[model samples]
Target: MPIRTEAWPQGTPCWIDCQVDDPAKAGEFYAELFGWEIQDGGPESGGYLMAAKSGAAAAGIGPKPEPMAGSPSVWTTYFAVDDADASAEAVARAGGRLVVPAFDVMEFGRMFVAADPTGAVFAVWQARGHNGAAWYSEHGGYVWNELHTHDFDAAKKFYRDIFGYTYTDFDLGDEKYVTFTPPARTESVGGISDDSAARGEPAAYWLTWFQFDDVDAGAKRATELGGTVLQPPTDSPVGRSTLITAPQGEVFGIIDPSKRVGEMPAPTS
Candidate 1:
């Protein structure tokens, strides 16, 4: 389990947090769907609710951004880094746009928001008192992160330069996708491919896959929990999967890979 510890390459993915319109409702929705325990994260933290599993941190649920007043809900993913400033700089150098400048969060960590070269948004974190989500892929935690973009080559090059991600192409016969491997031999972090090629969809964005013990069971639970099935459960050469949209309409997927879930998977970019 050589998961990248808190002290790894300057910028690594250590956590993911999302902002929702109704924190209480989001909490209720996730608690019912993922069996997560949602509780008040305290006043200093803007009364944010921390989603935990078995008392361990998994992800986060916070109030949605102001600009998103009436828009559907969405989850913002955060990557761990040694220095948020440095990572932001890399993003700029890679042709990505910085949505927000790095700022401190009391004593928890430093963070900022940015979009990839393809316009998909995400966050970067530099932990101080707070490192990241305590729980991971195995049970209701994030299992994988992937990028579906318009330009595969440009997106791939940008991430490689920014996150030091190594690329490998996985041929899925009729169609193919690329996997982003991190610095070590551990589980690969996420994957990427041309959004148009992968699903024939025009919108380009990054996708995160939450790992489940049972793909079919998770799919059923997703529908029962007020989510819509974007793609029904199906198995591919890499793994078994199903795509679903949250109550607010943000899209993501669930995976039950052929290989058993191992330690922390590396980031794709």
Candidate 2:
């Protein structure tokens, strides 16, 4: 089952969560789609719900912060670090902007939100009692995270400086992509792509991909649940995948890796 009991490596993506206007509705949609159990954290937690799979924490759903009113619903990817304060300093030194200052999360961890020089917002976490998600890379769990940025070189440099990441570039005919892994890790943790032109949007953003058993079926179910299928199920070297915006307008992706587990290219530098 690949249940994770230990903390992830520093600079690895260790947790993800969606902030939406309606937490209960979001919980219902994901619980049915991924067979997850929603555990309410009660009032003091501001209605945060931990989405669990097979009785282990997999993700989270919570109400959007008051300051974010009228903004688009979105999922946030959090990277792991040994010290949130130090990471925040690194982010600043790398020309990134901090949206939220480093702060303790009860006894779970310390965290802060920052946007890369390219404007892609992400979080960093320092684990305490909660070491982030307990499972991943399985059906109904997170498999990948990617940042789509307009400034490719700046994005690359900012992340590399902050996280000590190494990159492997892929030449996919007309388009180019680069997979990144934390220092001393062989497995790719995420990727970076210059996709703003294709989407006709200049604002950079992070995308989260969850593993599904059937990509087509998942896309279909999403549409039936009042969600929008931004990209139809399509095959890639790695897997079959689709992009979707949930009923609450938060965007995410799903992939079925049954046919091909594509090999990542060797690190270019």
Candidate 3:
């Protein structure tokens, strides 16, 4: 696996972190589940715990932001950008709502939180000293990040406006799924899927996926570590994936992407 030493290109999913109520418990849970070396970033960094795989940063666990304090724990995927302030402006112009305006992270980076026109929240990172995730897609690291929105067209247009993203649409059964490739990139890094009609009334949200060598075993281990298996391991074009929630109720997925079981739809963007 390639270890990313510097920041990712603009518009890619550079990093992901969860804001939970009990930081320590979150640390212990993920550490045991992924065999991560979790360590607290200390008081200066608000006691944020950095989870590393082989001494390179893999993900983060930290207390909720002041605005979201006491809210339900959840994971947020961040896109890399050249200037967070400019990106925030782009978000506003694209009809997205800003939950948190761009702000500095003590020289590591600048970031802001915002909800897409369809109401799915995400963040953008302007890296400085800290260059986001050191590596991804390996076992115990993030594999995919996707947005599940109610207004698929609006969400697609909003992100495209913000990041110059081009998409290839796919028909996933009766629902629509589209893989997005950022500007100047040849491959898709993430996807946008809106299946709310089939899923009933679940609110729009971005889904973060982590990889596991054994999908079933990962789901079983999650339950033993105080987590809940929201959906038992299921297979699709993406692979065998299980929708699971952490002990604190933050939803994420464990999937074995190598386990292909179906034909993928051709691009229709």
Candidate 4:
């Protein structure tokens, strides 16, 4: 079946944005690593830059909120919807909180930044002829989004209530990663997990993975572009994967898996 149009409100994988201390450095890092073209949106708009690939828009780069503190740099994924207000409402109704209430971006679109019950921050975009990201996963663009949460069931239930998502269970025996879909499709829109970290169990947060043709080559290029590798590419039950950080310190993932982002083969029993 085709992806459920009604459930998503807007199209799947609309756009992503990153808030960093240095936009110029971040722009240069991603431009070389992903083959993206970074164009300035000017200073009045916080010198926001659009990251595009092959002439199609992909993501955005902007300065960090002036008063924001204690948050590590990370890339945030935004899903497109038909109604930002309603989506923000749904988030609150499902036990999640609206970190940043719904607001407009001139004639661009309406947006509301939010966090899941487990504290994973993401955004919702309601396009008014100006959606967030124009292109995705074409050259070096965002291909997938995943969340590492402390409480899988609660997080799963929260998103299900908010977005009406169903899921596929990756039965890793004692533990599993339940990947969610927007309704009809088997492919995942995102994922939920519980993993160990330096500070005991890690807090819940969403992670985004950008696509690259070659995993090893991408890791090497990430280093060459002044980005740091958090986890070297290693074999996963799913694919070879690695964690990385841009020069501005925004964290993201890189995987040149055997399967495409939205086209993974069914998990075996």
Candidate 5:
């Protein structure tokens, strides 16, 4: 288990949460699907529910605020920041716009939401009393996050300026994809994929990937739970995966990392 007692490295994805119409219903859906124990944050927090895996924080399900009522439910990814105030300033300097100005979350932390130049919405968190996720990169927790954008180069430039990210390019055999490394880190934190010519011209958004023990079974369970399977289970370089929309209409990805194919197998195996 990869557990964290403190905060994630600066610029890495630190947390994810979905804003939906009915959080209680959405909480039940996730609890059944991921074997999570949902705990409420009470009235002070607007009934935000924390989904925990093995007694550790994994994700969140919160109700959409008044301004966003009836809007499409979606998962939002948050990046770790040393200072939310500083990050907001950098977002402006880098040509990104702050959707929500820096604000304190009681004693838990400070956070702000922003949109990249490509129109992708994301947030930055400066942890105080509450570190983000207690565990990740495991079943029932987040494994990866990627940005799907129309202007890939513009997206990369904006984030690089904000986080001092360095790029690792992949041909992908279609358009190009690149994974970005935060300053002073060897491991890539997340990916940026170009799909300017995609069939639908999908709006830019951050896609959060959660690990499942069995990808196919997970997809089956999701459908049984009133969710729709957007993409059937497929083997990719990342893992055996599927794209799904929850009952409340939040889009997310599922993968079983142990089922790797091609040349990416574990060394011991």
Candidate 6:
């Protein structure tokens, strides 16, 4: 298991959580699918439930805030930062919009939400008592995150300005995929692609991928639990993967890595 004890570096994706209509039902579904031990965070925590894998924090589940009533359930990815206020300013200066202003989370940390120029929403966290997830890149934990957008150049410039990300493009025959590497990192922290044009709607959004021991079985179980399989299991260079929507309509991906463990790509100039 890749256990994370300290804070993730600035610009690194450090945490993820889903806002759902029914926290209990969502909790049950994920618990069965990922073997997570869902623990209530108590009244002061606003009923947020921390989903743990082998006693380590893996993800979080919480009810949708009243301000966001009637919105579809969706997961939000959070990137680590040293200053939420500064990050929020950088977001607006980079042509992105702030959905929420920076606020303290009872001293655990401060955070704010923003959308990229292409309109894909993400959050930034300045940790205090709480440092994000305790584990990642293992079975039942977050493995990867990617943004699907129509305006690749605009989105790339927005993120590069805000997070100091450098790009490396991979030629995929007819499509070119770009990976964003944080400062001084050899491996990419996330990716951006313009394939949303093929989806027929030109919608931009971030997709999170969780690791699974067996993706075929995981997809089957998800469907059996009232979830929808958007994409059937398919083999890829990285792993066998599938796209799934939870019972309440939150979409995420699952992958079973072909290699025993995943490796970050070598740094590219």
Question: Which residue runs of candidate 5 sit more than 4 Å off their true CA positions?
Answer: 264-269
Off by over 4 Å in 1: 1-11, 67-71, 184-187, 198-202, 258-269
Q: What TM-score quantifies how close candidate 2 is to the native fold?
A: 0.95
TM-score of 1: 0.86
Q: What is the C-alpha lDDT of each candidate?
A: 0.74, 0.89, 0.89, 0.74, 0.89, 0.88
Query: In model 6, where do residues sit more than 4 Å from their true spots?
Result: 259-269
**Candidate 2 vs candidate 6, lDDT winner:** 2
lDDT by residue (tens digit), candidate 5, 1-269: 98878888889999999999889999999999999999999899987899998899998899876656777998999999998998899999999998778889889999998989998999888999888998688988998999999999899899999999988887766777888899857898898989887878566889999999999999999999999999999997678999999998899999998887776423221
Deviating ranges (above 4 Å) for candidate 2: 261-269
lDDT of 1 by residue, 1-269 (tens): 12323533443456776677778887887787778999896787786888888877788888865544675566777877878898889999889888778899898889888888777888888888877866776758887777777777888888888888877776544444787666753555677776655555746676777777788888788788888888888766557888988886777787877644334333333
Clashing residue pairs for model 1:
10-82, 12-80, 13-80, 14-80, 189-266
Model 2 per-residue lDDT tens digits across residues 97-173 = 99889988888999998889888889998999999989798878898999988788899999999999988898664
Q: Model 3 residue 223 lDDT?
A: 96
Query: TM-score: which is higher, 3 or 6?
Result: 3
Candidate 6 accuracy as lDDT: 0.88
* 1-269: candidate 4 lDDT, tens digit per residue: 11121223442556778888788888888888888899997766767888877666778988776534556676877877778898888888898888778988877788888888888888888877565555655447776788787778888898888777876777555565777777545566667765533256348777888877788888899898888888887776556778897877778887765733443446652
**Residue-level lDDT for 98 in candidate 6:** 83
- TM-scores, one per candidate: 0.86, 0.95, 0.97, 0.86, 0.95, 0.94
| Residue 23's lDDT in candidate 5 | 91
Better of 3 and 6 by lDDT: 3
Q: Estimate, for each residue in 102-149, the C-alpha lDDT of model 3 and write its tens digit.
A: 989997999999988787889999999999999589888998999987
* Backbone clashes under 3 angstroms, per model: 5, 0, 0, 0, 0, 0
Tell me how far the alpha carbon of residue 215 in candidate 6 is from the true structure, in angstroms, after superposition.
0.6
Residue-level lDDT of model 6, residues 53-122, one tens digit each, is: 9898899999887656797898889999999999999998999998878899997899998889898888
